[model samples]
Target: MVKKTDVLVIGAGPAGIISALTAKRYYPDKNILVMKDVKNGCIPCGIPYMFWSLKNPDDNKLGMDSLKKNNIDVILGKAVTVDRENKIVAASDGEEYKYEKLILAFGSNPIKPPIAGIDKAGIYPILKDMDYLKTVIGELKDAKNVLVLGGGFIGVEFADEFSKISGLNVYLAEILPRLLGNSFDEEFSVLAEEKLKEQGVQVLTNNKVTEFLGEKKVQGVRFDSGEEIKIDGAILGIGAVPNTDIASNAKLGIGKGKGIWVDEYMRTSDPDIFAVGDCAEKKDFYTRRRASVMLASTATAEARIAGANLYRLKVVRENKGTIAIYSTYVDGLVLGSAGLTEQSAKKEGFEIISSASETIDKHPGSLPGSNKIQVKLIFSKHSGILMGGQVVGGISAGEVINIIGMAIQQRVSMSELETLQMATHPYLTSAPTMYPIVIAAQNAAAKV
Candidate 1:
């Protein structure tokens, strides 16, 4: 059977949903349909919290009410083939979809490293599918020792969540020198390591998993140091790769990072088709080189850009580049980073100056719930342009880093930030005189 739509979205993840909704908002008269494989989807970012923090796992479900209310059509099936010539997609649902415009938001697949015994039964690769996650949770209900590989944000978060289990021995191992090394500098990485250790999570840094050990199921992992430890279950958080099978089958260009290549407007090689989310290639905001950054925030931004410019480029939204903004929480501590880190900037050969400021989140350090917030700003020494920023503190740090992200996007300079004005409250934010961002910028500006 042949079904036709004005705009057909090939996935229902964050990017797909946003693109569909945005298209509907801009072109209200267009018929929009979203196709997805999974009937139930979990909030990708909230998946780790489902293991401990969330009282009910279902609370993390990606609600479809918004789609229903907006009158966007949805179909469940896997896209198998894309006939670009015919402008149709063949799906496992046994239907042929014809679209005036096609948006490919196929998302990504978790990376399962090529280690011996990796196919063991007790190993779980973090997937966005809720049903699979529920099964993994059920299997781990009585687990005593759990090992999580990779010390990235997801791995660290999973280790912290598993540590919350009354009697679980959670272990987080990273090949890098410190946790979050790729995104944060040593000081911030060490801070996260310390917090995880304080939560009773055994953090093993500079450890490489040589192999997964067991006959039928993973019973232990062998590290590069010739050390092995028994584990009841294991989780793989190495990362993910773009799912571009359909696009590749259609002969669409792939980027250096293995994602579908898209222009600034999120349009693929075939102008009639568009791609977004994890499946789309991203360029570094500074270097303009291919970057592997897969965040729902970044995906939605691309979605908005693609959706708005699909037919006529109505909104003038263009994806300049990905800034690689990230935020994660461990216990009561929240860490947020945007753009490049000081270490990364130095490694990238950018003459950079960085400054740090520490202050109480609320005025009067004696406040009952006050927390010390540390902000670090990195700037190009020659241009004085903000390159990146990191914040470590209470919940405020999450939103604080976003401000830094905006500053980086707008090319805000140290001088501009020094005189930046912001609303401050005794109970809500740090004292105006000691605002961390402004202070850090001022300190850097003085050196400049």
Candidate 2:
């Protein structure tokens, strides 16, 4: 049987759902349908919380009620092929859907490194599917020792969550010298390591897992230094690769990063199709080089662009490359990084000045729940324009980095930031006289 839709979005992830809903809002008269292989999808970021804070995987499920309320159709099936010549998508079961405009948000797959015994039964890779994660959670229920490979956000979060369970020994191993090496500076990364260590997690840095030891199931891991650690199970969070098989099969243009090549308006080489999310190629905001950032936030932003411009360019917005904004919480501390770090700017050969300030989040330093907030701002020495920022503090740090992101996007300079105005309350924020961001900008300006 053949089905027809005005806009067909393949994949029900953040990108796919946002794109379909955005299309529905822009083109109210059109029929929009989103299809994915999984019937129940868990919130991607909330997956780690399921092990402890959330109790079960089902507790972190992503609901389709919003799609239903917007009159968007949802289908549960895996798309096997895309016939771009006829603008049709075929499912494995021989079902077909014809579309006027197609959006590919096929997402990504976890990367499994070529290590010996990697295919053991007790080894699991982080997946977005609900059922698969539930099974993994079940398997980990009786596990006393768990090893998590990779020190990225996913791996750190998994290690933290798994460590929360009583009697479970969680070990996090990373090849990099510090945790969160790609996003934050050494200071921030070291702080994360310190915090994780305080939480009873064995944090190993600059170590390579050469082999997974086991007979039929993973029992432990051997490091390059000839050290072995016994583990009941292992979770691989090394990274992910874009799922562009269908796009490649359809002869769509692929980027250097192995993602579907897309223009600023989220259009593929073929005008009738568009791509977004983890499966779509991204470019760096500063260098304009192809980047491999696959965050759900970035995906939703791209989806909005593609959805609005499906029929015509109604929205005047376009993606200006990726800024790579990231934030995470380990224990009670919140860490956020936006744009480039000091190390990244220096590596990129930019003459940069960095300034850091430490202050209490609440005024007077005597308020209850007050925490020390640290802000680091990086600026171009020549232009004095804000290039990046990092924050480590209480819950407010998450939103503070967003302000710095806007500064980078709008090309705000240190001078402008020094005199920036913000509303402050004694209970909510630091004193107006000693705001961390403003002070940090002032320090940078003095250096300039």
Candidate 3:
């Protein structure tokens, strides 16, 4: 049957929810509907915290109140296929939706390792599903020893959360030379690993999970280094696979990196169909290469573009390409990064000059809760343009690197950051004289 809406959004997480709300606001007279695969979705970013940090799994439940208030329809069903020519979406429940324009905000799924015994009863992969999470949590509660199968942020966060149990044993394993190798430099990555170590979590890098032992449930893990660790449960957080099966099945162009290819306005090959969130392939702001950077921040940006330009010509205010900018806390230290790392810049064949500064977050240094802050800025030696940056220490580290991300996005040069204006206070920020970004840029300028 033909049911129609002015705009239809898929997925109800950050991207889908934002797109539905924005579309309704932009075109208030138009009917908008958001189809959610998850009957009740948890906050995407807050899923890790729910393992132990939250008292109840439902604590992270996203309310449909906003959609109802905005007069946008929210449909609870999985999108099974999209027909661009016909402008219809076939949901798994056999409900069909017809749309004048559609926004694809379906997110990603965890990429399970090819290692044997991955299907064992005690093995679990992190997906944003609530029922799956509840089952995993129930199993973890009875597990005395847990083997975390990746050293990425999700893996570490899971390991740390699981470690909250008094007698729970947690071990983190990574195949990279260092944990968070793709996100931060060795120094920052090493510091994060060190903190996890102090948290009573085993840190193993430069190792591969070769096998999982036991007939039904995971009893132990074997590493390529000939090391075996006994455990009752295993959680895999290695990486994500974009949920682009519908896109691929529909014959939309997929990128070399395996995500649905999208342009500046989040438009897929078939302009009638747009893809967003972790399911969409993002381009690097600087290099224009396919970017593997996946974050809710990036997803929201794409949603804005898709919502605004769904039926109209592209909007110029926002470029869909994003610099990889993100921050996460490990143990008590906050670590953040934007653009490329020093090593990445060198490997990318750019002549790079870098500088760093170490200082306390507070000017007086006597503040009760003051934390030390370290800032490093990398730049093109020839042009003095900011290429990337890394910052650790203090809670503000979460947002500080975003300042660098913006700089990189706008291609701001060292000269711009050196003269950057920032609000400062002993209680809220670093002293004016030692503002982290400006000071870090100053040091990089000196080297250049």
Candidate 4:
């Protein structure tokens, strides 16, 4: 069957959904269609919580109500090939879609490293599909000892969630020296390790898994140092690679990071097509260098830009670059990082100054539900412009890092942050006199 649409979006993940909705908003008269392989999609970030926090995998399902409400057509099929010259997308089920404009949001796939016994029945890689995860969750209910490989956000979060199961021994192994090495400094990383330890999760750092050992199912893991840990199942959260096979097959320009190359306007080499989300290549906000950061927030932001400029160019709607901001909760602590870390900035050969301050989240230091909040801000030593920031604190830290993100995005200077005015309340925020962000900025200014 032949079908036609004004705008065709592939993949129904965050990027695809947002692109369809945003396109409807900008070009109300245009007919938009979204095609995805999976009927029920799981929230990418919430996948870890399905083991315990969420009642079931279905609890984290992404609904199609929004797509239906916007009058967007949703098709269930995997796109097999893209005929860019003719603006036709061929699906696996012998269906063809013709469009005037196309947006690719094919997302990504989990990185499955080749290791001995990796194909064991008890081993699972985190996937965004609901049905696959539901089966994994059912199997995990019987698993007493589960090993989680990799210490990034997904691995750490899964380890924490699995630990919540009664009598389940959760072990998290990271090849790096610390958890969250890519997003945070040692100080913040240490705090995360400490939190996970408090939850009774075995935190293993600077260790690499040599092999997954078992006959039919995973029974244990052998580390590089000749140490072995017994386990009933294993979850691989090492990382992900972009799903760009179709795009590559179409002869679209591929970026160094193996994602579809896109310009500031989110347009690919072919002006009629655009790419967003995990499938699209990203550049660093500071260096303009190709970056490998992928986040749903960044994806949606790119989608908005692509949707706005789908037909006519919207000069103000172009994407500047990815800032790589991230936030995660372990136990009861909230940790967030935005822009570059002090370690990363120094590694990039930028002379930087860092300042940190610790304060209670509420005034008088005695309010109910108050907790200690720690703030760290990084600035260029010569330019004194805000380069990055990290926060470790109570729930408020989640939003506090966003303020710092805004600072980094706007290139706000240290002096400006020092003199910045913010609203505060005794119960809702830190004391106005000793706000951590302002104090941290003041400290950095003094260093300058």
Candidate 2 positional error at 401, Å: 0.8
lDDT of 1: 0.93
- Pairwise TM-score winner, candidates 3 and 4: 4
**TM-scores of all predicted structures:** 0.99, 0.99, 0.97, 0.99
Tell me the alpha-carbon RMSD of every candidate: 0.9, 0.9, 1.3, 0.8
lDDT of 4 by residue, 1-448 (tens): 6789999999999999999999999999999999999978988989998889987568899988899999999989999999987889999999999999999999989999998889999899988999999999888888889999999988988988887899999999999999999999999999999999999999999999999998898889999999999999999999999999999999999999999999999999999999999999999999998888989999999999999999998999998889999899997799999999999999999999999999999987897899899999999999999999999999999999999999999999999999899999999899988999999999998887
| Residue pairs of candidate 1 with colliding backbone atoms | none
Q: Over the stretch 1-448, how does candidate 2's per-residue lDDT look in tens digits?
A: 6899999999999999999999999999999999989888989989889888986568899999999999999988999999998889999878999999999999999999999999999899988988988899898889989999999888989888887899999999999888999899999989888989999999989899999998998889999999999999999999999999999999999999999999988999999999999999999999998887889999999999999999897547788889989899999888999999999999999999999999999998899999899999999999999999999999989899999999998989999999999999988998999999999999998886
As for candidate 4, its clashing pairs are none
**What do the candidate models score in CA lDDT, each in turn?**
0.93, 0.92, 0.84, 0.93
Off by over 4 Å in 4: none
Clash count per candidate: 0, 0, 0, 0
Residue 237, candidate 2: alpha-carbon lDDT: 92
By lDDT rank, best first, the candidates go 1, 4, 2, 3
